[model samples]
Target: MLLTIEDLTKTFPGTVALDGVCFDLRAGEVHALLGENGAGKSTLVKCLTGVHARDSGTIWLEGKEISPASTLEAQEAGIGTVYQEVNLLPNLTVAENLTFGRQPTRFGMVSGRKMRAEAEAMLAGYGLDHVNVTRELGTYSVAVQQIVAIARAVALSGKVLILDEPTASLDARETETLFQVVRGLRERGLGIVFISHFLDQVFEISDRLTVLRNGRHITTADTAGMDRLELIHHMLGHELEEAEGRRRHRQGGVERLQVRGLARRGKIEPFDLTVREGEVIGLAGLLGSGRTETADVLFGRTPPDRGDATDADGPIDLRTPRTAIAAGFGYAPEDRKTDGVIADLSVRENIALALQARRGWTKPIPRAEQRRLANDYIRRLDIRTPGAEKAVGDLSGGNQQKVVLARWLAMNPRFLILDEPTRGIDVGAHAEILKLIGELTAQGMSILLISSEFDELIAASDRVIVVRDRRHVSELVGEEIETGRIIDAIAAHENGEGAMTP
Candidate 1:
């Protein structure tokens, strides 16, 4: 092993972020760090990068113990990291960026000619020699910028490279180009840490993988031997629960929401759906499969180019957020930090936000009423908070998510859409949120649920709607609902075959 970590542990206030995590990286292999959100993946990376001090651990590089007090020290010790977002100066030329602050100098002046010549040579090793080194980095695509960033990292610190979600913003062609560059680096014997949520890419690129759960390492093994299901099982710490009996769960009689040809070009293909009261429609798909797009269109976050939505009163506008709210629709978005929660606001304010929007701004809910509603739901939803005045951002991830749920539930929506509702929260909170969904549906509220976990989806949904490539493929109900069936529906290249339509 070129780099080894033994019994690494880190703790923060009220939580153990990492405990006895052990991992090793070989010189010429790609080691993937795999885990769901808040599974200590970030904490371990921070520890290695010296962003946080480890409580107890031993890190050895080439059989010598070295503790990096800061990122600069880590870079000096041959550890380099490239995050999802490119950090290089886009306005500068590729050559200038690669040699930033340390440009070749002659007679006490920077020499562009010297810098370009060296930078061109360095980028050549990363399969980017054809790119004009003198051109502004922004002139090229994001994929090109990433290659330039990697080249600069190797030029400064050559031993190890950490690629964090490198393909997130890339297209298939761009991802292939980046993968080629990574392969070249591996051939040259530099240990590479590949971190990504895309399981397909992990199996395609990583030589070995280490699964982390709840701040502890589960296992590390060669990628060739493990299938996607097995890898997910290891990361989730169990196999998905069988959905044998729940397929017969009956939907309420009243039709709550009706959609016909709802879609935006290049976002989602035209699709039709009917949500009866008390029904949970689970959207099953991999990332980029238009799950979020459907939710956005329904909630009026993105107005569809073409669609018709209706309630019992007949046609209603699906044109804006205000209309969606007026029509008794609520949404809890996937990225709670950005789209869902008002972090700076107090818990009471966050919970009262949707209601305020529903009721015109001039007619403010009284402070006494606000306090009572916030306190009532806080107790009802089990949101851990000191008081209604406490900042929602100060609470734990689970509590923040609960606050978002409380906001929608307070509005008493007829239809609710929850995208990745259980994400980034602890197991206990996840269960509570699921249970909350069950309670809501029991009260005859229609729900559109999106989750990566198949077990939860199968367990909660009356019918599973499968989407792929921005199109609805199939729908499953009754005895057809199961993890295996949903996986097949998601994986089925063409629609209809092996896909149960209702």
Candidate 2:
């Protein structure tokens, strides 16, 4: 092994980010680290790169035990990392950015000519000779900037390279070009760690895989023999066979909203959907699969360039969140703490926010009405707050999530979009939220539920739409909405085949 980690543990104030995690990187191979949210992948990377100090463990480089106190120290110890976003100075020239800190100096002065020559050599070595070294980095495309970032990292540290979602922002052609560069690096005996949410890319580029779940190392296996379904099981911490017994019959409902050709550039691809009254349309996809992007467009957070949306009233313009809210649409975002809840405000104020916004600032709901609305939802949703005047931030995660839902429900919108509604909550809260979904739909409410947990989708969704690479590839209805089927649809190649390949 070129690099090895044993019993690595990292802890925060009240949570353990990594627990007895172990990983190894061999020379001339691409090893992929796989996990969902809070899986300790980021913590492990930070520990290895000296961004976060490990509470306990050992890191061995070239068979020598080493501990790096900083990123510079890690680089000097022969480890390098390139993040999804290019971290280089965009205003500076490529040559200057490459040799910014370690420029070759002459007579106590920085030598510009030597720096450009060195940068040119570095690019040529990495097959990036076409990049103009004298031009400002910001002038180039993101793909080019990403390649430049990779080249700079390799030039700085030649032994072990970590590419964190390097192809995230690139198109198909650009991703292939980046992969070619990575293959060349692996050929030169560099141990490369490739991290990405795109399973297709993982199957194509990685030689081996390490899966982490809930801060513990789950399994390490060769990527060649493992199918996407098996890998998903490891990452999601669930068994597919257990997905049976929850496939219930769907209730055919009336069409509530019709969306045609809705899309936003660089966000979600053009797609058509028909949401039905009393129906739960589940958005199923891996992280970054445009699930949230789809929700954002539907709720007018990211306005679509060209699309027609209509309700029973007639054509509706989804130009902004306010318009969407006015059109009987509501959205509870994925991140509750950041986007959903206003921590400083009391529950009464938070619940009345959307309603007040819709009614306009001048026509504020009377304080009596606000209190009534807040107390009503608090009792109905079974919110565990002591009183409506309690600060929403002080509530538990589950209660906070309920408060967000209560805020939207107070609007009495005909359609609501819930993104990861049960995530980061306790098991009791998870069950309660699922129950609430059923109850809401029973009351003729249309819902778009976005969840990573397949069981939740299977249990609550009348239809499951599988998204991949920002496109809605497959839709399963009735008996077809099973765990394996959803996984197959997600893992299917863009060529429409059920198998994934390079």
Q: For model 1, give the RMSD to the true fold.
A: 6.5
As for candidate 2, its clashing pairs are none
In model 2, where do residues sit more than 4 Å from their true spots?
Answer: 91-93, 104-117, 125-130, 134-141, 169-171, 225-233, 241-310, 314-317, 330-502
In candidate 1, position 189 carries an lDDT of: 95
| Count of clashes, each model | 0, 0
Q: What is the C-alpha lDDT of each candidate?
A: 0.82, 0.83
Residue ranges of candidate 1 with Cα displaced over 4 Å: 1-41, 52-72, 82-248, 346-352, 360-406, 423-432, 452-456, 482-502
For residue 423, model 1's alpha carbon misses the true position, in angstroms, by: 4.1
lDDT of 1 by residue, 46-156 (tens): 799898999999999888887998877888898888876688999999988988855334413667788788788888766776799999999988888998899888877
Count of backbone collisions within predicted model 2: 0
